[model samples]
Target: MRSVEKVGKTVNDAVTEALIELGASTEEVDIEIITKGSKGLLGFGARDAKVRVTLKAPAEVEPQIEVISEVKEDVKVANANKETETVAPPKSSKVKNKEKKDSEDAVVVTRDELAHVQALAEEFLYKLLREMNIEATVKSEVVNNNRLSIGFEGKSMGVVIGKRGETLDAIQYIVNIVANKGRTEYVKIMLDTENYRARREETLKKLAYKLSKKAQQSKKPIILEPMNPYDRRIIHSALQDSKIVKTHSEGKEPFRRVVITPNYQNKSYR
Candidate 1:
């Protein structure tokens, strides 16, 4: 058996040398390209490129003892045969892992859709806020469940929020229809001023508890000030678990109010 010789050299100029020494064509040898090679740093550091080459006989000489030993060791732990069976070399001219419609797991929104939403919202918000004399700039924005959340950053966006964020809620409702005009699935628009909706939701929860206790104690149905439908819904939702009281909305649209009442069946309150 002819002893197979192994060669190693810096990757920068190793391919031709390896092929010549092994009496093999460039296509017969596997070339592995590695990134992040030794780079000189501050003109003081330099990296040495490296490559490994395995030489084979031109006439298919019998394997040497050392090569046989190494092959047996590789088979014992690496299952080299199994690894080769599992991984396949690329066959087509295209790159591997390219995006495929059905194979892709991520939700993809086209550039046209994103651009349409952004441009439409920007124009609408600019006009709406400018008309109200509230100078505000659109900040972060996102599309969720087909809805657009346009965050505004400006001096005292509290004006947009209005009393209990009624103005913001009304604006969002109207924008939702206009923004999603002629769409099969209407996108809900949310105009948030510095995350006002989240903060207001917390405040409403606290208010619900306070009103529930007050109504329970007074034994009278408290007709709170009229709020937007969303706000009324929030109040009702917040008191869903209260055993001492119940909440319901009264009136319509812009005049809707959340009324808290003591459990009517409680004879003491009645």
Candidate 2:
């Protein structure tokens, strides 16, 4: 990701200038505050605020496909050799339970219903944006036959994406409620502006790695600032495979935080 540094009257101004240079939004880049400028008395020692903004890396899809292809090849080889084997191993209980749960959770909806829900979600979003006096284009897509992904494009998205995306999340929550008001089978609705969701996920993953290293080096628990449940999940998943540290969340909603602790029992950490 490319990064740029800018100086302005305040941190927000510096970040805004940086974003304008990158042609990106606040959600699309990670901002680091370098200095909070001060307005000196009589303007003798005034200093401008400086900030560094870095564009986030794009999502990786090719690597996942390669991994899946390798797994399929292994499965094909196993199937080809099955005839010569005297016996085959049974599926694990975990696998069986998972399959059963998936079957029970699967809900079939007609094409008409899908279209209706999509239109409903889009209409509600348009009205909401109109009421907020923000003009933006709304696009919706069906993902995995069960989720609706909506994207927005326009100016002043920082208002829609409030601090840490609280505003965006609240919008999504209301949309979901309106869309599934009387439906027996619920469809998930996800909202994004300027690719905020993806960019935020990338930032959280990077933070997880950094904090994990800090915990391991210091041999102490590192508590992150409060994050929503969605963000906390990203942190936990990012560090789930680490050999030097473990992660978990503590506290109540809106104030819950993730804590990364060094795994002292692990030889690598010791």
Indicate which candidate wins on lDDT. 2
Q: To one decimal, what is the Cα RMSD in angstroms of model 1 from the true structure?
A: 32.4
What would you estimate as the lDDT of candidate 2?
A: 0.72
Poorest 10 consecutive residues by lDDT, candidate 1: 84-93
Native-to-model Cα distance after best TM-score fit, residue 29 in candidate 2, in Å: 23
lDDT of each: 0.56, 0.72
For model 1, the local distance difference test gives: 0.56
- Candidate 1 stretches greater than 4 Å from native: 1-115, 127-135, 143-145, 163-166, 252-255, 264-270
What tens digits encode model 1's per-residue C-alpha lDDT throughout 1-270?
A: 112222222352344334334443332345454432465777466654445545444454332335434433543444433421111123321232343323332444555665676677778888988888888788536553244668888886877876446578778777777776776544445678887888767776776777678567655555555555566667776776566776655444544455565676667655
lDDT of candidate 2 over 56-78, digit per residue (tens): 76542112324334533543564
